[model samples]
Target: MLAADLEYFQDVQNAYAALTNLHCIITDKQGNPITQLNNDPNVFHLVYDQETFKEVLNQWTRDFSKINSAIVYDALPGVKVIICPISIQGEIEFFIFAGCLLESTSKNTVQTYFEKILQNPEKANAIFTLIQEYSPDEIQAKLRKINKMAEVLIEHLATQNMKAHLVEQEENLGELLHLIADGNIKVTAVLERFLHENTKLDFVGYARKKGHDQFVIDECILPEVSSTLKGTVFSMGEGTLGQAAATRIVRFWDHMDMDPRNLFFQQKGIYPKSLFCFPIILEKEVIGIFFGGSSQFVRLENDISRVGKLTSSLIKVIEGNRFWQKQSKNNLMKMTALNEIFQVMTDVEDVKRILLIMLDLSINLIRGPFVAVIAKQSSRNSYEMVSRGLTADQIENYSSDISNRYFHNKQNKRFYHQQPVEHITSWSSKVLEIPIAYRTECFGFLSIGLSEQMLKEDELSFLMSLTIAGGVSMHLLEATTKVKMGQTVIDLLIEHQEYIDPDHFKQATKARELIKGFSGFSTYGKINTIAVKYSCYFIKYDEQFLTNKIKNDLIIDIVREYKLVADSKLEFSQASLNVQVLSLVWTYINEDENIDFLLKINGMNLPLLNEFLAYLSHTTVVESEIMVTNKPTANEPKISKHLKLSKREIEVMELVLKGNNNREIAERLYISEHTVKNHMTNIFQKLAVNDRSQAIAKIYQMGLEPEDVS
Candidate 1:
């Protein structure tokens, strides 16, 4: 909201003036009268019309806006002005001079204010009597009333703003369509007006990204700015502005005058107390950075949020520009790329070769930057993946077995998924997934990261056709190739057990095992998978590498000593491959004990096994959950809830039972030690105990159970 927005309502101004006997006028920041809202301006005319007395009038209003409150300003001896500052978005732009009257204390000597400025003192006796003596309390009451009226005014403006914004959005869509059709990328021109109309900042800058790290200022919106800001180049990650671009998150910095990180503004002789940086994002990539700041501290509403919405809408309107058919450039290539995928699929019998080519074709057809083939864990207990345009780090992030969790119970057709930021370093915003399935059995997933949204009807049809053909071909080809893969330990169980699919991992209720320090568990009919990675073959790094018969015994002892019933394992002995990957899925016939958490707790528990995990590298202990029946099993401990505790506190108590110190538990949970201590403190208060030992005793007495968490 701006001072100009306040001027739209004239009756509100008159009503305020009528409530108190005072001339109501809008004045410049320095207090010079600009527009009169009420008829009580004869006093104003006498002051402004008088050449010598106008200086005194200016002195009355000078710095009134800076006061930040309603005040009875003493303009001259025996005279005062009732003024209230109208602040919009924390910037004082103008003042409302509601009253010009004689002061109560100077009733008899009112002629003092007019001694130098009054040209005809005897003739203006009636004008002096027209001015009435006003109490400060009355003016204060009137000011409070104006505030109440503003509350109502704000509600009215909200409804009107929504209607206006809709119209503006429609118009902006039109502007964006023309730009897209013309192939022009001057997006700043479309965004500039909204900033000017809705905000009042001391300095506003727009920097366009020229390279990966380089950004050059294309424009700066401010009046009479003397310092050089435009054409200034800033690297990504240089300051708060760079951080916003790097993280794609909006950030605000305050007290920048005292911070050396404000060099961008400091160099321009503009030290802002509060500053905001917004990364202008398109297809999850920051093309520019928008900067806004005030030399003084100010409050912010959804000004940035509204602009963010508009910017998103801009991307959509251009990317999905309904007039796309008018340009034959994109439509011309749709069929050619569609034809190439079918030609490659019919002749390819190798599954991975076909998958790799399909991924490449997806990138070529859609102009997307990334594509991946995410396969479900095979019998060897490992997921085989092939990707294009994705880094090794990115590929690792996607191997989170999202499909295993996402498709547990429900079956989905071709779908679009926006990749969430797993951490600060990775940005994978949108992906289109086409499940590679043979009938109901989903063998793998085909995904394409969308650099442009809204696939054309024909383009989507072509992708669907390719995936359907590829799935059928891959499923038939895997029949013969699957014979030589590594086997699952489920076959080695003492009792013959039923076969289970690798993807069906339970997610809820089974987390009950966390209480007893088991990493993750399942009930009667459910199963859980625990994945582990190794650097190389056992022969290459281990002095204890054994023959085929001894190797099985060594691995079984190493695993059983840690209380795990290994359900599946994969070991690659080829000299050509540098790394050997292993995924462990723990399973049992009658639900025998498999304590997964012990491996992490025992820092030096298994020297040979720890060597297998790697002597130095960080071993991540991530847990995946599965849902079992709420009914407790025969061997499961039945504990009752007797005291109030938080979910985290109960989990902390579980780790305490495992004999883990505070530091170990902190590392295990990926939380700070301070947070673990806080949970411990809460646990102490709930159990009425002061130490870990006493709390553990009380927990046992209370019969702590998984369901007891409340």
Candidate 2:
């Protein structure tokens, strides 16, 4: 029994020895040491102290932090040992104290003990001598390798945790991408979800293009805080995210509080403590930027790498989606262009009108700030109106400037020699050049303005299409302008007989009174030069031509006649008529018609007297008998034409014509009923009318309607 007990004791000693350098001490319940292994026997007494012994025995009841630091005390003369509690049937039996090691021990010797423990004591002792003979440097180097192995084990465990986290993040990212692709998810929603799910990070903000600037926010992910941060500019190199976007790189700032002082954060009120910004690059261009931050400073290499990888992956997906989006947009733009072309072709007769509509459409479609069609001017200074999105004031100013510089200057050879240059305006120094063609005799320059963000190939393509479409629209507009001019000239000739001839004027009045019982037909005889030109050029010379051609065929006749008679004696003759007729039409046409006709013919040439007369005859005619009968009375009526209407009658008549009730008229005119009645009774009797419609009709007949009389 003594030999057996000794063998068991040797086994325990060998087991203790297997943990070489690492002190091991076993103490009984009575606080006496049962076994101790180490070069220093003093470690057993120190480790088996009452306090340490009780702590080791109370493992089941103690917190983990309290038990984690248990180590042999004598290793450093004061350090305690790590204790492993051994129990027998739920009762404290003995405590195994270990983990203290002298700094002088060779790390390889410790490792050899670990390896030898798998084998036996003979092998363990054999390896121990070689390990113990190693120099301090070699032992440290060996310890580093062992530490590296431990680190590998820890890394494996960390990797498992990372995999689980990455899986969840991927799912979240996938959902966000789905929402973005769906297009129903707003930018705010996407950012909010990302920040909310990514509990480890605080989402700072995002940036998007708005007109000529970038719209940035501080806490768009948090709605409660977004309003305070909106409408802020994140210019290039301005903030972390801005810098990242500007440089097209990932930027990591350890501490934002330590950032260099600048206007970016100070003015923008975006002072983050720690920040990570990544550029959302697509097609090698930074389209947007994303930022994540923390309120406290923390460095996470793994997190940085993960974010980089995730951003890169997301960028790839976004780029692919952008490609498809561009394709779809291009197709949609093409279809829209075609539709606009069709609508303009069918809807308008004036090329200028069509061009204007086209400019508006292009501006809206491309979402550009400005659109213009620069066409070759007839004179060095006089470019024809092609199309523009410029305001009236801008058009006038531009036209005046062009006229002053180039109009009719024979020395200006550049007009015939050079190609039109299309330029897009910039907010500051840089002007982005949109690809366009500039050829000699180029129809016009089509220019559009874009937001500060770089445009993609598809956007450029759409712009090119707009320029091309402008050309088509311009052509259509010119053709329509000519047709409308001719129609207007015809309409004037048909209505205004007085400007044609006093005899024809009387006859037209009689004819109109006989046919429509309305003397306003004479108003149509008012002839603008453009109208007379249209009559000369486009009207077929015949009796039917007089009736058909001189009736609303004004624009066509003007352009055709101008072209036909531009160089001949008839050209001069027609030119004179064009001017005289335009003047006469200005004087006699209804106010609305005059305004419209002046707008059309304000800059056109005139026709000669003979052509004007000819146009007038075709346009206006009276019965021969009426002309004969009215010959004597024409001079007298011409004198009476200047008679003035009384202010009261004018006021009463105007209100009556406006359909105002008598009391309302009285209130508006500030007159009593008896006076209003007197004025109305005289107005009716003098106008030769009894009822309201007839009175209105008679007023129109007298050519006294606001537009007609004016």
Candidate 3:
């Protein structure tokens, strides 16, 4: 689709060049080569690469749609120039370029150039001399007439093409109109075909008013026509079309010499005897004059009126079609814009690429000479160029200036409104400021040079969508990175724990505090569960004894170690060992056959133990506790009541009644220094004097024995 559009535009440009005897080329706003006719391709490459040249071109296109022979010296090093902007559908689609003169040239070259320079002082001087020799007043009048003719020529061409494009729904009609208005050969062919088929008169040729003063004709058609009507404009009330266009009324001349009322008609040259003029009314405004004349001396009042009516009706139809076509095209452009945005969303991941794509798309849609994405800098004097169409060196220079003004100053957002800079080049010749913001966070300002055509709502909406989409994607990417980091830490913790020593597994549990905190898993239950799982092997290996004393010692040790790990100053005094005893009993019964000595020593019977141990080994400690606790509590209260003595007394009586040794209690408690002797002395005194066996016998008599406590 894009290629076909370019080809159509190229054909029109070529036709314009051939008919007008002028060089022409079409270029993008950035000065990049799109298509060229009767001009060097390298010219576009050179101009586009030169920032200064592009800036000048941008300025020229902004002011007018046509520059017949205007001089623009800033483009190539050794080139004179005439440039015109060819706007279509509210955009500068192409520029018409002509002339390339070197600084130094031969006399013949200068003469050729002089003839083409429309208002050159040298040519004016020669014409003025001849007029002064003849009649000074007449000379001044002729000069004015010539200038007016030039203006009319330019205006006629410009308005005709604009009007034709306005009416026709034909694809590439804009280009076709441009070619016809410029008096191209193809347009002449088309007009010749129309005239030959529609009229009996010998067609002289066609001419279009370029402006208020100048008229242009197809130089290619001048030779074949019999009359000298090419490249000429009649003074007001002088010729058929000129009189009608100047007076804004219809005019007809039956004979050049015989018509008494047509005082402006001259008999000095061969001229059309009968002529009719009609005003081309467009949108209730007379845009130009249309003349259809012949040498047959025939009356054309009815034909003139009919043609005038048809042309007027045609203009109205064109205007209506243009209005709706523009509306529909804009709608299509908006839809295309939406589709492009969707594509960007799914295709881009790299932030830099996304930003560049956004910038490129914006420039294309808006048809601007420059577009850039600027990122906010942290420093007060610097900003980063996230993406831009400017050349590398140009971007570097612009970045340096932007850094000094906005980035270095640490301004959140700033607008540079039409601030003229020698360095930065764009189409507007004036800077446009648009701040790039997401929510309240301002990234930076996006700057572009708008041509004569301002950006529409759809263009702005497209830009806004790009900014929002880019910001959201960046945010999501950052969040994903953090999540990945967390997962990595968790994985490392799990891996490292596998290599940790069973006895030193407590350290791993302690280290998990850091991981839990990092991962946001700081709830009490969760922390406790993790700590227990991580340190379970250590507890099982070291504290497997079910005896109350040993279990009580282990609990004290565990509490002390926990306090040390926790870095707490608070001490854990003696606590009941019942829970530890139950835990230890469960651990021993649950040990596998390979470590079954643990169960054998805990009072398991041989064959029955073998069968039960196998079954119990597969069971969890929690499940075994459920089984044990559910057995029976019937005799438990009676036993608990008989063992109502103080803890120290129970210790002494159990040892003494068993007849082992008094020294054992003292050694176990680490309370030495006659503590065991005193405990024995108190036992005998409490039992009413006695030997060790008598004391034990009395304890049995009093029903205070191991059976009751157990």
Candidate 4:
């Protein structure tokens, strides 16, 4: 039995992959994986995983030979498995096979097979969702092409075997293999020298350019011939080189008249009696073509054994070069894209405009045709308000479906899921949702379509790293902008502090009431803290307790004035002047103590904001919280038995005690307003109270305690 090492088979497998979509596997005579079976994503995984399929595949591998060519076996429903035999020293040594090739036109049958295997309808549906369907004729044509290529591959392998024995005896031939295998010389250079020395003929090489689909003359001897053929493009099946490439077989023309499209002879006018052509194949597909011609009789068939071995070695080097070149290109593109993103975020001040740029550049960065940025609203579900390459109808469709919201998770999360659209002809149905976030705060999602030609795992990993960095950069920009605005507010407060007179109680009261108009920060506790802390600079500690009374009376007076302004239909900005005045008064009222609170509230860097705050304010000793009692409470006997509220009613009443409105209470408890109102009515009847104020008063009066009320 002839045995090949795992590395050798792996090289062959990689080379064959460049030529076709069908998964190929090379195995030893015993049917073990050559270099370990590819884990489940490959066809071999399926063949090896299922016992029924494995038995059929193993039997076919054993029976395959040069005599029988190959044996067809069952793999998946409607999919055919074909194994071609490789012979070495007059015995079958290896078996190469292609699987998951559809033999029937029915896609349903294929879907059913996967459904049975996986037992998941959704997964089965998704497997078929992204598949580009092929007709029966197309499938048959593909199979025929693959089968012919397999036959040529088998012949090439046999030729290598024959040449191996010859190489052991011939030192020059062994050196040629060593040189080409070691990548010391280009495969074309060695092939050209070998052909001229051994057969007295020049070699011509044709390979596809990196980005272009058409084949071009790559390497050749004969300066005149090379000059004439340079820059010439050949489409598949157009000329002799193309024919050799398309067929993946040796093409021979013993007479000049036999091949009319042979460019060397046609363009350079160098007529030869015989010409030999062969394809440079990798992974089962043609990557380049080779041609050699002689002015006299040249035994091409006798030399095929040596030529095939050299060609295989050349393929390895070419593949390696292509892989590195593609990686380099992708890295450069990624860096350029990331640099552009950084520039836009750094320079752009408008958050909306910055977001738009981010959404636009993300499409090109990921190479996806469709892209979108979906942000979650505070009150409702996440929505797709902005998108690129999507129609109005598609946007509307996405907005209505809650499932389309991929950025709903409060923590940073990512999803790469395939979404099936009604229109299959759209750019792509596959989608990836990457969370745009900083730390634990997710701002939005970057959604993009997935292309069929996806980035390799390493490239994808690099892209994800950049994406996370980009998200953090965006978050920092937003925070920085807020800090800048807060600084502006601080400047306004310092510049206008003298405009308000402390002795002018009307102006002071008006300012206080306007500040109270801002419901978000007008709580009794917050107002008292602002007053006590700030007024300490202007008032003594003994009189500091009177500052709270002054702040409270001013707020009450301002509220009465605001109601009069509302009755007279006053301009909002005029009413807003009161707030502006209050900001100045409060700045002075809190004295230097407002610095820390302002810095914390605006999310500014503590050290930096402290420096600015210190430079703007007159330094004063900041006091600790002074305990102050609210409305007097009278001790009462416990009356817990008199109030029998259901758990839900007590929950609502506790929210009422915290001064939450009906909507806020409902939202906090995750209930409806109508339900909250019903709870309130029940609590009112249980406590024999008229409104919220009396209900709370009775709860305190009865001294009824509730568990976990807070």
Candidate 5:
């Protein structure tokens, strides 16, 4: 506790003086006279020996604050004053002085002695007038009364100081607790304050015991030393701190150089003489060690006990903070994964492609071997699926022959299923299957292999939610495909209504009405019938047709107009024509190809007759090999529009094509390694490719030119 402000306590000084009828002055424990309470000048100050009295007063002040009783001292040769020591809590905090009398054998002798000290004969008698002469008995009574009053004042001051000190300590402790609660104050900061306020030390450090026998100094705060000691690790019994850690006890010694194990403070110009080491115990185990050094020998038990209480609490606060930080990081990662999966599902247009992305995401998220999606075929009583590490044939056979034999009804057209129980089967891998259904309609099933660590309960629930969302999105995309197909049929029939036969025209008109009502395929059947009556066939691109097997009279595919260059040489008249034409595909073969061409029964625009044969003309034809290539043409720029890449993905892809690795790309882009990796994955997924090599090849095929990363 800090010393009280004695300069403002003049009332105590005046009270002592008024009761004793003597001038008084007060001073503190350090012997610095605070101030004179009474400043009246008299002949005693003028005639007394001033220089000799000032010297005596200086010596008296230094010797008096510790005294327990009142004592009389000669201020001058014959003049005297009484000094009383004032104490609080058994330690003298202040001293009170009172002027008493001047003594001599006779008035003339007193006058002559004062005249020699003052060097003025006129002031010699004036000094006797100011001095209060008292009998020995009277002086004794006054001294006793003054001593009693001074003691009472000291007791009062002691009580006040105790209250102030208690309040100060409480406030300091409250602030420390608040700092811990905020988590902004570190262990090093707390140690700095504790060492400064509670102990006199040149250096202090806190170290954590790690591994088998290593102690790492995590937070080191030193006032007199400027060298850094943090992150310094030492083996057990290697240094002062290490020894304390090994023994699990407080250690203290002087002559630091005598002990070669003290490595903390040693210099050519300055040597540490003393040091202390102690352990912070929690639950019968030492969690941390405290080490500090001073220039003088410290009280071992007093210093170690004081610091041990502080460090024990400090360790607990540190542990709690680290636990919360770890939990927060885990939660953030989980949320990011969930958000990324949901975004990929709702944003991608194709249902099959979305399933492929989800499979990749789930495999990484669960650290598993494979994930699969099995969708029921629309026109057959079977299932079609996409998977990783498992073939569609394997999935179809398993669900049909092995799984359905016991679990599903082969005759029933629709099946409702929750997740299937695990069992040994003909398949080589274990699998977990959950139904992918939304509301009342069951679309398909999701199959995940049980080859690695299964997800936690909450993670599994999130996975289930993702699957349900995927099913709903797929159902919507399926409905959209059907609507587009129905609209295409309606457009075809309406475009050729005039050329169509009268009966066919009425059928085509009715088909348009059915398509508008969204009665899918029932309307297409009617339109197909009408086209058959006109001797034209409506055919979707069949896989068998790729080998020149023609099962229909009209084949529909997305054939470019330029691919039909051979048709320009056909021989024809306005009425006479007999020819066969074939269209070469120059674009991607889409599964849902739109109708872009119409053919008549006689392969002519107008009716052909035998009478118009005279006008028939022979035409020359040139043939060339038909090839579909994503390779850029001579006139086409290397940067083509076919590769639909986002701006950020394109930036990353350009760097990838330049042969920059993930780390290099992250450095160039000023992003984290994890973010660069995520971008690379996104680029691969968007390009419909797997690794960096495949992604580069696919982009090159789309005429993407390489650019410098810089």
Candidate 6:
């Protein structure tokens, strides 16, 4: 157990983890997980990615070892854990990842993260409900518990390894275990130390089996032999070395002649009276052979057992290096691959494509051979499953269960779900479900067959990034499909505001469901109805590039301008692709004043828009019957934003409404009559009216409409 007596430390680990509600794991210096079966199953609510946690440990060694008590927020998914250096004596022997227990830093942190990133309140709330909320004092108390755990673990480790001194006792078996477990010791170093530390042996040679027929001296301590016997090859079953290779056991020739036993050695003018050879076996097969001889009578029986154990330890050290090295490379590659997948996921809008990326990412994240995504194609479609690494029969079985049970609850709202896999070939058979959702719309869930039930912080966070990406893609695709729904659907949704007939208006009904899926709405008289219209001469565009530029600018202007009022929890789309028209109804939550975003785009005193089309927008304050649910009523008066016309045009319109002529308005304003007439003309053109009477009526209707259009 990670080169320490952790068998005794298992209960301590589980107790601390259960008591503090922080994920705890101990890894050796090189970041390999120390197997502890007693880790509390209920302690972790999210993921416990072994590879990602190892990466964190490696990062600590490289960048944060000095700051051992650092609590890394967003360390794993939405988790914060402090990395404690589990030291023995003065050197760090292991690392303990302790928890402060959070999905985000605080409630405010979660809100801010979702607002700018996914901007999904349902997800934010789901997270809030799962995580154990900690106050300042409570958090401090949890942290103290972590520090105390670290202290106790280190104290126990030191006490356990303090029994014997390595320097005084040369052949202690525990010394070899600790030495090879350091992870930096090379195989050559272990073999060399085996002979160099023993003064009784005159020469040594480690011959690895090549081609299963001959053995070659891959490493040698026989300096007295001629021609550097490092690469010496000999036939098997001929001498002591051959006998060791033949028998797969320790072979000692204590009373043999120096001429025949060291025949290969005597070929190079070397002579030894006694010699011993042994097979280095791994998994019950001879991998190599080690031979050494003495110039005098050696006590072969006394040191044979120690040497056999030493050879086994040597093989493990070599293999351990190779294994960890390969693992490190694979982890780096997985991270790079995950980043690429996440980047591609963000740009993709198709449900199938996004789920495909999620499938690829999930398998790599958990090394799970099978992964599946179960979701509804749309509001009307039946549940479907997308998967990787499963047989057709398995898919059918899983999909039936998931669609009928997982999707059975039409009103299912959850953070996550874990279920035991039946007919398990191993106890490691466990399944985890992370929903792909945005706001409260769950398109489907990522059902992952995990190697273990525990999910890492980094894994959950990484999966969270995928989940959020998929959710956003689903929502954006739905919203975009609705807004550009060929004007037929949009017209139907706008004109027929009553209950929709499910059979006749399928698209409109689905669009309304999508609208309700975005969030709940209440029928109130304060919704901002933002409408954008084009000028009469706006058709002065011919070039494709020029039209594209104009369309892009107008689309940006429409969405950006609409965002002026609703501001938060709003996803807008272009109502008309050709004219850049858009309409979205939203009200501010927890606001005290009414949303009165007045966009007054008049040609008079209008700044020229570089070289492209000039955009003019006028807002109508239509009191909506649909207000966002759970929003505060406005106690303060309405705050009017940008107006339709300039100050001069507004003043001129006021005089016109007051039954004054242009000359009287000019006298009152101290401006020229031409200026007053020009202002009126600009107002008429912007409002798209011909006469003063129509202009006044349009302005009055647009500026202050008190009708309940619900």
Model 1, span 45-121: residue lDDT tens = 66555565446546655645366666666655566666666555456655666556764566656764464457667
| Best of the two (2, 5) by TM-score | 5
* Candidate 1 segments exceeding 4 Å error: 1-9, 29-59, 62-65, 75-77, 87-92, 100-136, 142-173, 186-303, 309-332, 335-710
Per-prediction TM-score, please? Answer: 0.33, 0.30, 0.21, 0.25, 0.36, 0.24
Steric clashes per prediction: 8, 62, 39, 11, 0, 11
Model 4: lDDT equals 0.51
lDDT of 6 by residue, 1-710 (tens): 54335653565667777787665776676666574533443223333345664576677565545545534445644545666677664577676666535632465675467556646666555544545656667767776776777777675555434323322223433344344434445556656666665667777777877786787888777655555567878767867788777877677766555355667776766677778876765434466776777777767657554544445435533542343344556544544554455446545667678777788777767767677887786634356678887778777777776666546655444433222223232224456777776544567887777665566544654565466556655656665444453322223223222222333344433423422322222222111121222211112223353233333344344445444323433322222221212222122111211222211221211111100011111122223324435532454211122135765676676666555788999999999999998998888888788876565445444443211110
lDDT of each: 0.52, 0.46, 0.44, 0.51, 0.54, 0.53
Candidate 6 has an lDDT of 0.53
Model 3 clash count equals 39
Best by TM-score: 5
Using lDDT as the measure, name the better of candidate 1 and candidate 2.
1
| lDDT of each residue in 474-550, candidate 5, tens digit only | 65566554444443333333332333245545543443332222212121122232222222222222334312332
Local error of candidate 3 at 47, Å?
95
Q: For residues 1-710, what per-residue lDDT tens digits would candidate 2 score against the true structure?
A: 13322333334544444534444444554445555444443433433466675555454234322332222233223222344444432454444545444335445545454455446655544433332333446434444433332233233334444645655664565455444434344545556655675565654566654444364553355333332455566666665666676787777776677777333554545455666766765434566666666655656334554554444434433333444445676555554454445444334645455456655665665654455544553212235554344677665655454444343355643452222233323222222222222222234444454456655665554444444444434444444454444543344344333322455455434423222221113333333433343343232234454554444544444544444443233423335444334333432333432222322333333222222222333333333335554443432332124324466666666665555667888899898887877777777777666755455545543434332222
Ranking by TM-score: 5, 1, 2, 4, 6, 3
Better of 2 and 4 by TM-score: 2
Model 4 C-alpha lDDT per residue in residues 441-547, reported as the tens digit of each score: 55565566667876455444434433443454555555554344342222222222332234443344443443333322222222332332222222221233323
